[model samples]
Target chain A: MDSAILLVRVLDFVGTFVFALSGAALGVERRLDLFGVLVLAFVTAVVGGIVRDVLIGAIPPASVASWHNLALAVAAGLLVFWFARAVARLSQPVLVFDAVGLGVFAVAGTQKALDHGIDWPMAAVLGMLSGIGGGMVRDGLTAQVPTVLRSEIYAVAALAGGLVVVAGGALGLPPVPVALAGIGLCVFLRLMSLVRGWRLPVARPPEP
Target chain B: MDSAILLVRVLDFVGTFVFALSGAALGVERRLDLFGVLVLAFVTAVVGGIVRDVLIGAIPPASVASWHNLALAVAAGLLVFWFARAVARLSQPVLVFDAVGLGVFAVAGTQKALDHGIDWPMAAVLGMLSGIGGGMVRDGLTAQVPTVLRSEIYAVAALAGGLVVVAGGALGLPPVPVALAGIGLCVFLRLMSLVRGWRLPVARPPEP
Candidate 1:
């Protein structure tokens, strides 16, 4: 049980780091000031968890309860700001990490929801939300329609990851393997979709 | 105490209705479908209170916990959709209602935070956030820059409203009158700024 908790915590930290990196990268692309970039990074990294926590009655969200989350966000933001070109050049690696982050957050959020006595259905939905919420906010702040609302594969990947966790729990399976499988499946789906250019059909703009 | 709670609840409902109306109006202007317009209205009405409730550890959030909030939002949205032209002609009334909504949300959010044992400084900030959050989300979802991020007087009005609540709490003043004063000040500031065309300086955009 302790090990499982530790695993979730570690994965959560990793997820925060990767999400913060994505947010900071976007901030740089948008030419935000350093303070704005850091704020965006912190918000992206934790907004999902914060939303989940608030829903499940977890006061003082985990990220807000600890210093580590902010530290990671600050580090990621500073790294992006100080090494803008280098970070930009690392797009491929960043994408991979971002996918991993999404997978972990989906699984972990579902797990937490279940632990907090939420039903599986809501837990799964919250899990998907936890995976996508940060990016949604980030895009909204940047005045872009959120990719999660448009992309076919992004939300599917997270929902699939959540389902794995829910199914495992219902089947009385061990936690660690279920989580690992969920993450793996999510990353696989997300990456393959990107490679194949999978996208939902977009609505045409009204005639101007 | 009971009456005070009732006052907050009543004002909160009124706030929800006005905010929802504004959101629905925006959606109609944007030519969104009926379902989209309703969604926007509901989101705009409740998001601010949801944020406040979550931060203050109010679980199931007042907006989410009560059916009345949703009902009010739906009612307001439908009214706008069915009477689009009429609603447009009522823009002056709508703006006044919107400002009133902002004022009540700021004061109520601050009062709740203080009740939850939050410090004055943070309570004031949260109050302003509660007032502005809904519009920010509404604008962001519609792919526009949020007015709260740009406008000087809007947030200031909300902050002052919050400060009034905090001051009342600190000075052991009666709740209802303090709340009334807060709301009145906020509405006055917001409306005056609009009438006078008051604006903060904007940074120049970089040459494309």
Candidate 2:
């Protein structure tokens, strides 16, 4: 049991780092100052989780209770700001890290919501929201259309993973296997979308 | 009592319009496409109130239930986008509208939270949050530091107004007078800050 807890903690830290990196990368692309970068990192790393907890009546939220998330965000922010030139040279690192972050957050959020006694469908929706909310906010802050609303299939990836978790739980699958399967599906779908440039078609403007 | 309800509805509509205008102005400044402008307007006008409602267990929130707010946002968005140059020529119209919107939201949020049985301090906090939340989001999405954080007076103005409401409620004052006093204080403080360039001192960066 202790080992399982430890493993989850590790994955959570990795996910935090990835999301922070993606946010910091956007800040750097926009040439924001150090304060701006750190702010963005914090927002991306923990805002979704905060929103999830608040919705479920979890006061203060996990991000405020645990220092690890803040530490991870700050560290990632510093690293990205200091290595902006080198990091920018590696094209599309943000996309890769964002996918991984989404998968981890979706599974974790679903598990947490279930623990709070919310029904499966609502839990799935909240989980998907937790997975993509940060990135959506980050994109909006940077004056770009939210990637979720664009053709990226981002929210859909989270939705697919959450549904897997819901179904697995219904079938009485063990939590470990259920989480792994959900996360794996999410990561696969997100990556595939990025690689293939999958997008939803825009609604046509009304005729004059 | 019927008159009071009518007044509240009128104030709410006016607040919604002002908030929508602020958001549309931002979209125009950023040169967002029509869809982006509409999205920003929708988000800025309703996101804060929606968040406050959801936090207090008001499901779906007012923005989701009523189509009026959505129509107001869309109208403002289209107007701003189509008359971007003309709007820009009107010096500081956004700032004026934003300040009025903030005052209106602060009073309304406090009153609603009290109606829902929330205590004074928490209600005040929610009121301030409702007033500033949308602008924070709007600024963040535009790749700029949140004005609420930098313009310390903005949140403080809301806080002052909310505090008045709490105090008046505690003293068994009528709701109408309490609301008017609160709104007046918010407007006065915001305008003073704008005209005097008042700002909070930012913490200096630590020396390495």
Candidate 3:
């Protein structure tokens, strides 16, 4: 059943690029040094996949070992660094990129988990983690609570998408189409939250 | 050559307990809920070991698969929760615990990497990562710059300890004594740094 290796690879790179862009944008916006920006770009782009692979007993995670991913991340970082003023002006686009990245990462992560014979429930968990883990580490290096853990309607959407993919697989659906549907739903939910200003409720304002 | 399995196991538990205590203390000081405190304790206690395990191609990391570690973390959390005022009064102790945890984790991690047949340079790096990884994640969850990345002699101490272990191995020394020497050096350096107000240099404060 691990028939979706190519699909996972394609989606992984797509997610990497978009996530790198978002990470670079955030680092630039936060006024980090160029080195810091590049670090953010590289880490934000690949950490999710790395974490997923590590958990699934994949050694030397593909993203970590690939120079191509590094080149792409550096390219994204440089673009943001060189266009700081312009990038700064387009703050809203960062979230859009993040949404796209989340969708693809989730779908890819789920498919990879399935490829490795992970069951649906644990697979969905891994998939959702694959979607959000990078952004969490990105925010961490910036010294902030992860938006996913704070007020964003983020993790739920990722989990939902992962569940969709696994469910489709159970129904004997084609991998590519099922993956596409999962990505669509994840992106839709994330973007909708941004547009609608929807937020997960905080128990209370942190006790200051 | 892997003659120190017992040493590693002991060190791991020691590190886990102290790290969990420090994390629990931080969470209580930060006035987080019980759930948050426990999460912090659990994560801070085991994440370093988990990361080290994952990198070494070990499945379901010993720390992650161990209920004893969880019980210890929860116990630490509960202690802090029930005695918040007492814990809040002992801020300096938290740093001490963190330093101890770092030392033990570094030693344990170095030994494990060597046992896994990893080479020296990579083993040392992995060891340092193990020492610092948990504390970094703990600080991140609380929405702050990792103290290790900022003004601390943290990574250096861990790395140096790791080097000592590897050097001892290369010099044809026994594993257990070498590990203890490594741990001693790490703890000494960290403690001295605390006493002398030593810190890693920052180029300049981040521009506000």
Candidate 4:
């Protein structure tokens, strides 16, 4: 495999693991049983890509067709289940890992959309969708408002990364550099928002 | 259009209207602003079909591709927003409407899957998905556990309806009669569950 492809694959696995961990942690906090925790983790790790694949006409969804991704997600969930206390102490690290995953998925999704002959604008949209879709489903399953819909910077960062990929790809940039740039932009924006505690303004209550 | 196709379209619009009304009512209860109400209504009215269409590789999603569907959903939302107090008085009617919508979507989804040459088992699954997908998204956006996952018999009704469609199709039955039988089965099961308070067993909490 090409080095670029290899790097992407590695990042994908890393992202999936950390996302699953976060989901499992949430399940534990919610006092969900083992099955619910596993379900949440699997859905959180894979739903984004599945939604993207479906939107782009990838039949059966890659996550459903392949066992590798499902196994990794399930393994991560089981690990968290077993080491809940220890993993709880790594909250900061988990956040960082999640940011990395967000960046990687955003660029990867945009690239996939482009490969499928989608226009750049739609590719960018699909990238953001791919990046935020899992977290949305995770929060939904846990009965919480999705962070992307209400948070300060989640989807925006993903959108920024996707736009970068679209621009870079459109300009005939090298694949590795384009991917790296998008990832960097997304991670930087996410971390900055987290540290700054910035938030998107909520709509004021309508007058009765 | 064939008479069967026309009937399907009429039922589709009826389902969309009632589903949208329910979603809009929920938005009102949540005190969501006008935009949120419209969004909830639109999602509830169409998401199930969109999900089914995507799974079956029907590109562009029938819901997104049609202005008529969009208009009806929006109108339904607006009606609820403006007349919520009055609408609330008709709770009994709403339940009946919701059951009808559920039944029709279940059968329609299965038929569409078969038309796309999907196998019967998968078509049945997709049919259930189509019947329940919109409600899941609607509840999720409102920060609630999906009714299908936790409630009495929502998804069961859909699954039963889907199976009927699959069986009827496989037996070379006429489309109109098969579809009606599936719808009747779904509505009956759902209403019975509502009246009798049927519930799926919840998983036991894991040993701490």
Instruction: Assess each prediction's global lDDT (C-alpha) against the native.
Output: 0.82, 0.79, 0.83, 0.78
Q: Is candidate 1 or candidate 3 better by lDDT?
A: 3
- The model with the greater TM-score, 2 or 4, is 4
- Candidate with more favorable, higher lDDT: 2 or 3: 3
Candidate 1: misplaced stretches above 4 Å?
A: A31-43, A54-89, A92-97, A117-126, A140-145, A149-153, A159-185, A195-208, B2-47, B54-104, B117-129, B137-145, B148-208
lDDT of 3 by residue, A48-143 (tens): 999888888787899777698999899988998998888778758578788999999998998888777776666776788899889988887887
Kindly report which residue stretches of model 2 are placed more than 4 angstroms away from their true locations once superposed. Answer: A1-8, B1-50, B54-112, B118-208
i-RMS for every candidate: 6.1, 7.9, 6.1, 5.7
Window of ten residues with lowest summed lDDT in model 3 chain A: A199-208
For the record, the alpha-carbon RMSD of candidate 2 to the native fold, in angstroms, is 8.5
State each candidate's clash count: 0, 6, 0, 0
What's the TM-score of candidate 1 when only chain A is evaluated? 0.90
Docking class of 2: incorrect
A best-first ranking of the candidates according to their TM-score comes to: 1, 3, 4, 2
lDDT of 4 by residue, A1-208 (tens): 7654565566567667777877777776666656556666777887788888887888866564445776787798888777777766664644665677788888888888887889989898998888888888887777677878666798889999989988986798887888889989999999888999866787789899
TM-score between predicted and true chain B, model 3? 0.91
Query: Candidate 1 DockQ score?
Result: 0.12
Tell me each candidate's TM-score. Answer: 0.62, 0.57, 0.61, 0.60
- For candidate 4, the per-residue lDDT at B70 reads 91
The clash tally of candidate 3 reads: 0
State in Å the error of residue A76, model 4.
13
